[model samples]
Target: MGGFVRANEPEKVISLFEELKEKLGGGMIYDGTPYGNLMKAYFMKGMEEEAMVCYSEVLGEGSKVRFGAVSYNSVLDALGRHEKLDDAIKLFDRMIKEHDPPRRIAVNLGSFNVMVDAYCIAGRFNDAIKVFGEMGERKCTPDTLSYNNLIDQLGKNQLVGQAEELYKEMGERGINPDEYTYILLAEACFGVDRVDDAVGYFKKMVDLGLRPNANAYNKVIGGLVDVGRLDEAQGFFDQMPEKEVKPNVASYELLLKAYVEAGRLDDAIKTAEGILLDESVAFSDEMKELLEGALRKVGREEDIAKMYEDVEREKAERAARAAEEKARAEALAREEEERKKAEAAAKEAAAARASQAAIEAVLGRRKEAAKEESPDGGSNADDGGILKRLGITNGPVEEKRAENGNVVGASVGDESVKQDGEAKEGAGSGGAADQATAL
Candidate 1:
């Protein structure tokens, strides 16, 4: 059955299992190894439901099959791989609780490690931590794999501090970290912006006789570049060839991007030339575009006409984006202008209304004053009072009556006529007195 499973013949394996079950009728017993093999076959064939059924049949109450730790671990691994993390945890718990003491299938460190890895893959970090804690309770000291799994997940999730603590604990517990451990620690340190710590760990990995690979070098260089340590990154990148760890396309691309972003166009051109010169590294279109952009930045041209189309396309995209931004800005400006205009017009309208109200209020007060002055339809006293209130006074008046009893002349303040009449009267009286005395 295992051979069949290895040969990718799941149907034949299943048929064989069915035939074996039928031959070993009612009271017969079988161990879990065959069932595990069958489950593995089902899992390999993408028949997850059938695989789970096989696992259940092994642990079923009526079944005489006794599953050992290896079989249980296999099923647990399948469950984890299938993203059935909750089921895997349940199975792990069952193994610990149900299979202990009687020792039908004792959970081992591999079981815990599998569960931890599953939880990490599912991003269930808390659950993974719980499993890690359970290892200590079970007196199962965690190995390097356990630490690496946890650290890698935590680092990827950007939980660098926790990853660092775990790495420290590994050293304290005398678990010699492998190259993978060092790589994870360096990555975690880099994730948290601890560039110096990352570099130290990377170097420490080399000192421990774990050959630093291209991946390790790339990580350190990338970290340095991320922190704007372009010079340091370039220096490290230059050392890759000496270490016999040839620079990969990613390494060159990182250096190129850093140089371009830092305005070191000359350095970027050199890196681009290195990329082009290396026959091992495939010149992908992305790399070509990056190189072309760097060349343009330094006001240089390349004979690679294939890259010209990409450059022109990028330019068109940039122009379109710029135009969209300009249009959006213009719209915003127009809105702001309209808002200001509306506010000003509203203010002007309010001012006009206020001015009209003030004028009406003044006119109303004058009307009230006029009504108070003239209670009747017409009153001379009231009119005179109004004139006096206005600082106008009536002067003296002279009147003349004609024969028809109609007043023809009415003059005010005729001082010259009054003076002449007074003088004539005085002379006439004097003449009468003198004539009477002579008589």
Candidate 2:
């Protein structure tokens, strides 16, 4: 039957049990090993209704079959797992209260744990505590494991205060809290915003010389991260090494994820480096891929080849590449700026030359006209013609003059002014052609 159960051949076990019953026709089998196996087979085959009926007939009032604590705990677990809480409680009551030989201790510590677990499933946490309290009346004094089991269920449901009461009770009862006990208490504390309580439990565990595993450290660190106590989270991570507890991938991953999300890439990279340094941890591809997928967005992902290489060398290479890229970009920018300035200066010079050429051409034509007009080597009123072509008005307005001995301003447009080729050529500089026509 055990073989059949291990093979998951529940129907075959049941059929064999039925055949054995038939062979023994009018006799009652009071031994519970076979009956318990039958119930397990029923459960294994998902025959919950049949299993429940079988449990009642075998263990109910006036029944000859006597199931010990092992069988009772098994069925209780099944009931708890399947959410058959009410039935589980009723069976638990019978186990504790069964008085054939008046042996209440027939229900072992497992019986109490199972009931606590069942109550936890139903969210009847106070009832779970009550179940533990009733253990004394049942003549079963729970050891550290029993307390740990009950506290584990309470912690799972975030019943921090109740779990703490249990922890307090353990100390009072002289049962030393183990590593798992402290770990569960710490998690429960964190679950209920009691950060100080959580940290204290960790300290308590250490003070008692209990070596916490990577998982224990991770739970405390993760709780600290959850409540935005990032500094404390980082502190715990750092303390792991000091305590001789090596941080695993999960330990680093918790802080890495927190750092990256908080826009702290440097911190994330630092945590990632810690993972690479720990050779004991298999840096599986899934974990590596997860980290890279997250870090890739910020362009801070570790180089896979460099992950296994010399750390300092990898850092140096990355810094060199970044500096080289920066310098190249700056150089390109400076070249672009220089090119633009040179183009602007060259255009200005071209415009100045064009303007000068236009002025020279007009002056040359007037110079020829002046030569032809004054062929007798005397002055004519050619000044007016030259001035008219130059776009200066022929006016008697004395802008500047010297009357006898009195002084005045320079005559900028005095019609009486006379000049030969040199004067006209000199005056051509201040021409009416503005820079607009230069190009």
TM-scores for all predictions: 0.55, 0.59
Among these predictions, the greatest TM-score belongs to 2
RMSD of each predicted structure: 26.0, 28.7
lDDT tens readout by residue for model 2, 318-357: 7899999999999999999999999999999999999879
Clashes of 1: 0
Q: What is the per-residue lDDT of model 1 for residues 62-170, given as tens digits with 9 covering 90 to 100?
A: 8777767787787787678677888887888788886564445468888888888888889888888888878888768999988998888888998888788888888
Candidate 1 stretches with Cα past 4 Å from truth are: 1-54, 64-66, 81-83, 97-105, 121-124, 136-139, 207-209, 261-263, 296-298, 302-439
- Whole-model lDDT per candidate: 0.76, 0.76
lDDT score at residue 82, model 2, on the 0-100 scale? 64
